[model samples]
Target: MADRGSTELTNPLGALTLDQLRRRTSMKWRRFPPDVLPLWVAEMDVPLAEPVVRALTEAVALGDTGYPSGTRYADALAEFAAGRWGWRIDPDHTAIVPDVMLGVVEMLRLVTGAGDAVVVNPPVYPPFYQFIVHSGRRVVEAPLGEDGRLDPATLAPAFRDATTGGRPAAYLLCSPHNPTGTVHTRDELSAVAELAGRYGVRVIADEIHAPLVLPGAEFVPYLTVPGGENGLALLSASKAWNLAGLKAALAVAGPAAAADLARLPEEVSHGPSHLGIIAHSAALTEGGGWLTGLLSGLDANRLLLAELLAERLPAVRYRPPEGTYLAWLDCRRLGLGDDPAATFLEWGRVALNPGPEFGTGGAGHVRLNLATSPENVAEAVHRMVAALD
Candidate 1:
C-alpha cells in the first residue's frame, strides 16, 4: 500500500492508507479487502529483487527442470556463506536442502535415534518441537525465562536430569529467537555450546532469520562462537528475502559435524528444487543491497509499532525487536492470556501469529510481522488498539 519512500507517520504504527493498502491486497489472495490487514504470516508484500527474478527467469528459459545431479548447488551456497557470514564452510561440508525444517530433520537423523532426548528453548519456532516429535525423539523443554532469554542455570539442571539415565542427543538453537526477537549474544550461545557439548549433545542452530537484525544490533552466527561449530547451523536467504517458495537452505556442518552432512541419504539430496538453487544463488550473491534496504524498512516499522503501542495500547509491553521482522507483544496484563492471537483475529480483524505456537512461555503473547509497508503496520496497530479498547 505504501511505497518505500513514504514519510514516517507520527501516529502509532504509521501504516498505509486504506486505498493504497487495498491495491496491494488485490494482487494477492482476495479473501480480505485492502483495509483488512494480514500481519500473521512471515511473508512480506514487497516485490522480489530484479536480480532474483531475472535469475529464476533465466534458469527456467534453459528448460532443464530435471533433478539436480550433484554438488554444484552446494558449492554455490558454500561460496555465499563464506562471503556473507565470514564463516568458512567447505562446500564439501555444506548440503543443499529443500527447507530449514527438512535440514533439521536430517540433522536429527544424523546424530540421534528414536527415544533420545533433544532440548529446545520454548516460545520458539513451533516447528522445532514438531521436528523432534516427527523424528521420534523425546521433546525436552528448556523454556526461556520471562525476559526471553535461555537460562543456563535452569537449563543445566534440565540437561542433567534428562540425561541422568540416558544422554540427550541434540539441542535446537534459535539464534535471533523467534516470537521473542532477542538475538542470542555470543556469550549466550557460547554458554549453550559448552553445556550441550559437555553433556554429549549436539546443537542445531536455526539461523534462517539472520539477515533481518535491526540497526545497532549485531547477530552472532552460532558457529562463530566458541565451540559453536561443534554443532550445525541451518540457514537460508528465504526468510530474509521473502523467498520461502524457493525451497533452498543450507546446513553448515562444523569441523566435527561435517560427517553428519555427508551421512544424509541420497534421496534427500536429490529432492532439492532446481529453481530453488538458482534463486538462492542470486539472493545470496546479489541480494545484499536489497536486503539492507529491507532491514532499514523493518527498523522503521519497529519504531512505528512501538510508538503506536505506547500512545494507544499502553497496556501492551513490547521490547524493541533485535532481529527478524517478528515483534513479540506481551499482553498478559490485559487478562487475555489464554489466546491472544485468536482474540486479535476476532476483534482486531488482523491476522497475527499466535504466541502459544512458540511453546509454554508464549501463552500471553502474539508475534506480529513488521516487514510490510509502514501504512499497513500503522493500520494494523490502529485496529488492534481499537479492538482492545
Candidate 2:
C-alpha cells in the first residue's frame, strides 16, 4: 500500500504496475484478454485505502458479518458532505439503498408512475437508459450541447414533453456526469431546478461521482440550489473508494421532498450489505487522507492523458474532464467509423467503451477510463496510435 497520508504528493494510481493489476480478477482487468489493455470501465486501478482495509479486516476477524442497521452510513456521509462540500445533510432525511442506480430507481418510483417519462441528458451514462426502462418508465432525451454542458433550451423541451398530458415525470441528473466528466456548476444546477419546477418534473440526481471532482473544478450538489427543495440525490463512497462489490448508497431527499422519500418501501432498506456499510462508513469518516491522495493522483493522470493524446493522437479531440476519471474522446477525425471503440480493440488491443451505447450524440466517439497509472494511460494511447498505422 502507498502512503495513506493526506499529502498531495502521494501517487495512489502509480502504486501498482500492470502485472500486479492483471493478477486481480476485477471487471476492469479480467474483461479483456491478457494481450489487451482494458480502460473501459469506471473501476480505479488502485489498492484499497488503509482505513477501509482495516475496518473490513476487523469486522471479518470478529465474524461481524450480519444485517445492516442504524444511521452510521448516513451520518458518515453527512459529515463528509459537510466537511468536504460545506453542504449540510440531515441524516434523518437520508435512506440507505443497495447502490446508486437502484436508489435512483426507488427515487423515481416516488415521483413518477409506470410508463411516465424520465428525462436524461445524453451522450450520458449508458445505464441511465437501461435501469430507467427496466424500472417501467419511458426515456426522454435532452442531449447535452456540443460542448458537453447542459443546455436549458434542450432541457426545456424534454421536460415539457415528458410531462405531456399532466403525467408525473422525473429527470435523472448525473452530477459530475459520467463519461464526459463535466461537473455541474451551481448556476447550471439552479437553471435545471428552475426548468424542472416549471414543467412539474421531479429531479433525481445521481451524484456517485461527486467525490471525484478534480482540481480547478467545483461540484455543485443539485439539492443545494434554488428551487431544488423538491429534488432527491443518490450518493455513495463506491466510486471514489472503488468499493462497488460492497454495495451500499444513500438516497437523500431535499427539504420539500422528504415526504415523497418517506413513501419508499421499508423493504428497500434490507438490500444493502452490512459489511459494505461498515466499509463505506469507515471510508467516509476515516479515509479522507487517503481520498486526498487518490484525488491528487487522478488529477495528474487526467492531464497526462491530455498530453499523450495531443502529442501522438492530435486528431482525436479530448477535453480534459472537470471531474470523474473518465475521458470522452471524439475519434471521428481518425476515420474509425461510428463505433471507434471496436476498431481500437480489434487493431490496437486497447479496450475503450463504445460511445454509441451512451445514446444520442455518442457516435464516432469513445470513453476512456483515466483511473489508472500514468504509464497505462500513455500505453493505451500508444496502442491507439499504432492501430491507425
Candidate 3:
C-alpha cells in the first residue's frame, strides 16, 4: 500500500529528475560527487516560497532597498504568532533584531548585570553559553534530567539555589531544546514560570525551531503560560522557511518586561536590510502552505533516517526527536575515537554539527540535520555505515 501520509521529497514520485538534481548541485558551494551529501548546515535545498521570491523581486523593482523600519515586519510577525502559537503580542512588544542569538544577547543585557548569574540547561544550544559570557555575566550550568524531558520538578531547585545568594537575573530556556529537540510541555513551563516568579528571575525562551515541529507535536508559547509575563521570547521564521541569511528575527516582550528592552540603543531596530523585512513578512503572511509542505517533507526524512540508523548503526543510540529538523545521535557506543562531527567528516565524507557545540551533555553525540531531501539523508547515512565498516 502506498503511504499516503508520507511526503518524502526524495521519493521518486515527489523528487526532481537526476538531471534537475545535478543542476541544483552545480548551484551549491561543494562540487563533491553526487553521492556525497552535505547535511551539516540547517539550510534546505528547497526552492524559496513563491511569496518570498515575489516579495524580494517586488522590493527590487521599486528600488526600495534601504534601511528597514519596524511597522510592517512587526505586524506580520505579530499576526503570525497570534495565529500559529496562540500568543497575542503587540507590535510594540516586537523588536526586530539581527537574528535569534543576537536577540538573546540583547535581551540578556536587559535583565542581568556584569558578573551576575544566569542559569542555562546543558546539552542545549552552545550559543547560550557564549551570549551570557559575552554579556559579562556568569554562567551557571543546570543540566536537564535524563528521560529526554524538561522536568521542572527536577530543575526548579537548581534555579532556586543559583538565586539564593543573589538573584540569578535571567534564565535561557530553549523551547524545543536543541540537540535533544525536546518540546517543553505546558505543565513543565508552568513550573518554570512559578520558579521564576519566586526568584524574580527573567526568562528568555528561544523559539526559533517552533514552526518546524513535527505533526502531532504540541507547541505552547512560553509567554502564554502563567507568569510568562515576567520573561521575553525570541523567534525567527528563518528555520521554518529556510531564510537564515535574511537576518530576520523578533524579540517579544511581555508588558512587565518591556521596560527592560528600553535600555537598548535606538539603533538596534534601524540598520536591518529591506529584503529581510520583505522576506520575513512574506513567509509569515503568505508562506503557510509552503511551510506545511516543508514540515511534511521533514517528517518523512526524519522517519527514514531513524529506521536507517537503527538498522545500520545499532550501537549508536538516538531516540526520535519530538520536534525540529535535527537528530541527536549518541556516538559514544560506536567509540568513533573523536567527536562524531569530525569523525563523520573524515570517515563518511559528510559534515555534521558536533555534540560539544550543544554543551557538555552532547559531548559524545553529533547533530544530524535531516531537513534536506530524503535521498540526500540516505546517502549520508549510507556513507556513515560504509565509513564505520
Candidate 4:
C-alpha cells in the first residue's frame, strides 16, 4: 500500500506530461526518437525546488556568471551533512569539481599511475568502466554477491590481486550503489575500510546518491569508518534535488589525507559553472523542507512500482531497491534474449539503460528509472509487458 499520508505531506516531486517533457532538450528526451518513452538515464522529471530556482535566477539577474570559487558550496554541504547525516565535514578539506566522475578521475590521477588497476563492484554505474579505462588504468572487477550485496569473500581476493606486483591501486567505491540501489550498511563499509588498509589500497568513494536513500535504510559515509581516515569522498546535491544541469560537486578528504587533497590541481576548481555553485549551495542550505517532501514522494513511488510490476509483469523478478530511484530488473526469465533493453526499446517504444553496459552480471538485466510519476511507472510496465508478448 502507498503511504497516502506521507505522499500527501510532501511537495509532489513529479507530475510530468509526455508532451511537456518532450519539449525539453536534455539527453533523456533527445537520445530517443519522438515515439519512444525515455526511462533511461539518471535524469529526473520534476520541477526545480523554489530555492534552487531563486538562487539561479538571482545569479543571472546580478550578472554573476563569472568563474566559480569559494567556501560557500563547501559550507552548505557541511551544514547539509551535519543535519542529514551525522558526519561533520570540514570545508577546508574540500574542493569543488565539475561533477562526481571528473572528481573521481582526478582523484585517481592523484593516487595511481598509468596502467595501474582501479577496482570497482559490478554491475555498477557504467561510467566506472569508461572513466577508469580512459584514464589509462585497468578496471579490476569485484562483482557484487549474488544477493546483491558486497561480500568480503569477493573483496578480500580482489583487493589482494589488485595490489599485487607492487602496483599502486585504488578502490573506486559507489556508496548506496547505483543500478541496484543497495544502501551499504556501516558494518559493510567498516569491513571495506579494513580491507583497504590491509592491502594499502586507497579508496575513492562516489557518494552522489547519498541523499536519496529510501525509508528503512541508512546511508553511511565511507570516510566515517575507523580505517577510512585516508579515503576520499565525492558529494553533490545534484541527485537529490534534480539539479544536474547546473550543479557541481565537492571532493572531500578524510582527516589523514588532507595533504593529498590539497595536491589536487588548483585548475580543477575552474570547471564548475558559476551558477552551479550558487544553485547547489541554495539546495543544501535552504531546500531542506523541499527535500523532505521529495523523499516522501519517492518513497511512495517505490511501492507503487512494485505493485505495478507484480500486476503487469509478474515473471520479472525485481528486488525493490533500497536507495536511489533506479531499479535493476532481473529480466533473464523474460526470454527476451541477453539484452532486454534492446527488446523493450524496439517492441514497446520504452527506452531503458542496457544492462550489459554495466559489465559482468549485467547481461540479462536493465535498469529502470522510477523518478517519474506513478502513471509513467504503470505505463512503462504496460509497455514492457506488451513488448514481451
Best by TM-score: 2
Q: Please give each candidate's TM-score.
A: 0.90, 0.97, 0.90, 0.96
Model 3 worst lDDT window (10 residues):
1-10
For each candidate in the order shown, give its overall lDDT on alpha carbons. 0.77, 0.91, 0.77, 0.88
Q: What are the per-residue Cα lDDT tens digits for candidate 4 across 37-83? A: 88889988887877788888888999999988679999988888887
Candidate that beats the other on lDDT, 2 or 3, i.e. the better one: 2
> Which window of 10 residues has the lowest lDDT sum in candidate 2?
1-10
Ranking by lDDT: 2, 4, 3, 1
What clash count goes with each model?
A: 8, 0, 0, 0
- Candidate 1 TM-score versus the reference: 0.90
Regarding TM-score, does 3 or 4 come out ahead?
Answer: 4
C-alpha positional error of residue 14 in candidate 2 after TM-score superposition, expressed in Å: 1.7
The numbered model that scores best in lDDT is 2
Candidate 3, residues 292-351: lDDT per residue as tens digits? 777778778778888898888888888777788888888998887548777777778887
Model 4 Cα displacement at 339 (Å)?
0.6
Over 4 Å off in model 4, which ranges? 1-9
lDDT, candidate 1, 10-55, per-residue tens: 2222234445445653323355444456787677766776567888
Assess candidate 1 and give its lDDT. Answer: 0.77
Higher-lDDT candidate of 2 and 4:
2
Query: Quick one: how many clashes does candidate 1 have?
Result: 8
